[model samples]
Target: MSIKNTIKNWVLCSALLAALPITVTAGNKAEIGVVKDFKVTSQLASRDQAVRMFEGEFFRDPYIYLGPDDYYYLTGTRRHHLSGGSKKDWTSEGVELWRSKDLSSWELLAVPRRLGDLSWVDGLKAHSDEVGKGNARVWAPEIHFINDKWVIVHTTSVRKAMLYVADKAEGPYVETELSTTIDHKHDPSFFHDDDGKVYLTHRVDTVVEMTPDFNELTDNEFKVKPANRKMGHEGLYLTKVNDRYVIFGTAWSTDKIGRGSYNMYYATATDIRGPYSDRRYMGRFLGHGTPFQDREGQWWTTAFQNGKTMDFNTITKAKGLEKKKYTVFKDGIYLVPLELTVKSDGDVFFTPLDSRLVQPGPEEVQKF
Candidate 1:
C-alpha cells in the first residue's frame, strides 16, 4: 500500500470509531472495549520513561505472574473477547493467556479455558437474557504457578468465582471442587506465603486458605481489612515484601463518589490476615493494575486506559482534569515503574517512579 493510501485508511477508521458510541451496551450494562489492534499513532510514553507495551489485544486489571519456568505469563479482563466486540466481557467464552521473556514483546499462548470447559458455569447463568446474550462472563482472570502446577482464578458476572487447575501454564484447564466454595466473589487473587501456605482473596478483603493442590478452600475464611478504610470497590490483589503482607485494591479518586479517575490503594500488615494500617496511594489511574517484577528484579505495576488514563504531566497537574482527555492510547496495557520503600518502622510502601505518576490527583477523597 502506498503511504498516501495508508494514511487515508487510518483517517477513515478513526472517523468510523468516533461515530460509534464510547461503549457498546448489552442488556443494560457497559463493557470495556476489547483490542483489535495494539498499534497506536504515537507511543504514549518513551521506553526510558515507562515500559509501555502493545499488542492486538484489549486487557484490564492487567496481571503478569512470573512462572516457575521463569517466563512471565499475562492475562486480564477479556469481557467482550473475539465476538467482534458485541458480546459483554463477563460472557467471554473463556480465559486467554500470553507469555513473554521480556515485557515488551508478547506472544499469545492459549485460550486454555473456554466458558463451556466448566459445566458449572451453565448452572449459574441467568435463566433470562439478563446479560443480553451469552453465557456467564469472566473478569479479572489470574494465573498462578503453585504446587508444581498451574492454577487460574477469576470472577464472573453472576457474582461467583472459579478456580481451575492445569498441568501446564497453558493448558486444558479443568474445574475444581473449590469453585463451589467461593460465592459472591469478585476480583480474586492468589498468594503463596513464605511458610508454604496458599491463600486466595476476594471481595477486596475476605480470604480463604487453599489446599496445596489448589482444589479445595479450607474452612478458615476471614477478612483482612485496612485500619483506615475499605480498599475501594474492587480489583483486590496480594503480594509480600520484607516479611510484611501487602494488599492492593481499586477505587475511584473521589472515594464513594463514582466516575472519577480509577486509582490503586494499598495497605500492609505483619500477619497474613491483618489489622492493616491505613490505605495509601499507589498511583493515579492505576486502578486494578498488577504490581510485578521484571527479570532484572525491577518493580513495575500494570496500567491501562480505564475511562481516562493520565499522562505523567497531567496526572500530577490536577487542574480541570475532567475537561482534559488525559490520555493518548485508548487500548493495550502499560508498565509504570515503582519504588518499594521500607520505613524505619518496618512498613513497606510503594511509590510510582514515573514523575507524572508519582502523586495522587486533586480528586482523591482521602488525605493520604
Candidate 2:
C-alpha cells in the first residue's frame, strides 16, 4: 500500500473505533463512578517582545522541560525556505532546540544535525533495493535525561525512528540505530516509570519497552488501546499518579483540516504495558498537545489553536477523577488545564474552561 492509502486507512480505522463506548474506574480501589463537568480559564500571556522571541514560522511540537543546566529547554521541527516552493525542496528538516528560564521566554541553543547527516542512512540505503528510495524528515524531537546522559528520539520518513545521545541537553547529537521497521512512526515520546522501566510511545498508539541502554526495544512493540483509537496522535507522555500509569495524549481528526477543531484525551492503567482502562476526554481542539510538570508538581498541557490567530492555550486539571485542570490560549505556544468527565456508558468529554479564546492569523504558506 502507498503511504497515502495507509494513512487514509489508519484514519478510517481510528474514526470507526472512536464510536465505541469506554468505562472508567478509579485505580483498583474505588467502585464509585461519577460523571462531572469542569471548566478552564484561558490564561493568555501577552505576546510582548519577550514572548515573540520564541515565535518563528516553523515552530510546532513545543516539548518543554528543565535541562541539566537547571533551565527549561524547548525543541521541535524547523522548516527551511528553499528557492522553489516545491515538495522536493523539503529536505531533511533538522530539529531546533531553544532554552528559557521561564516558560514564556525562549532562546535558540542549537540546530542539531539530521539523521541523514549521520552514517545510519548508509545502512538504510543498503536496503533501498527492498524499501525503495529514502527520504528523511526530522519530526517531533524530544529530549530526555536518562542514566546521566541526555537522549533524543525523533521520527523520519525513511528509517521510522532513531535515537541520538549527547552529553548536554542542547545537543551536538550522534545518531544510534533503534528501530528501522517501525516505519511511519512520528511524535516519539519517552517515559521512565517508577519501577525503573523506560518506555517509548508515539503515533499510531504504539508503545515499546526500551533496554536500559535506551538504544533498542527489549520486547515486541504493542498498540495502546485508548478508548477511541482513531482520536490519538501527536506527542504522548506518561506519569505515575496515585501509583497508576497515567498516559496522556491529544486526539485529533485524521483529516488535516479537521484536526484543529478536535480535543485532547487521556487514559490510565495499573500496569505500564496496559490493558489500560478509564479513558477520558481531557480537553478539546488543542493542537500538537504536550504536558509539563511545574516545580510545585502541578501538571499543565501546552497546545496550539488551529486557523487564523494561532493562539496558545495553557490549561490545568480542573475537576473529575483527576484533582484539578487548567489551560490558556495565545499565539505561538499555549497551555491549558484539562478535566475528565465520564458518561454512563463510559464515554468521556473534555470541556474547555474558556471558549472564546482567539487563535493566530491564517498562515500565508501554501499547503501541499
Q: Which numbered prediction scores highest in lDDT against the true structure?
A: 1
True-structure Cα RMSD, model 2:
14.8
Candidate 1 lDDT over 221-260, as tens digits, reads: 8887789788887766888887788888877677543355
Runs in model 2 lying further than 4 Å from the true structure: 1-6, 9-53, 81-92, 123-134, 179-184, 227-235, 253-260, 305-331, 337-368
- Return the TM-score for candidate 2, rounded to 2 decimals: 0.66
CA lDDT, every model vs. true structure: 0.66, 0.50
Q: TM-score of the candidate numbered 1? A: 0.79
| lDDT score, candidate 1, position 321 | 59
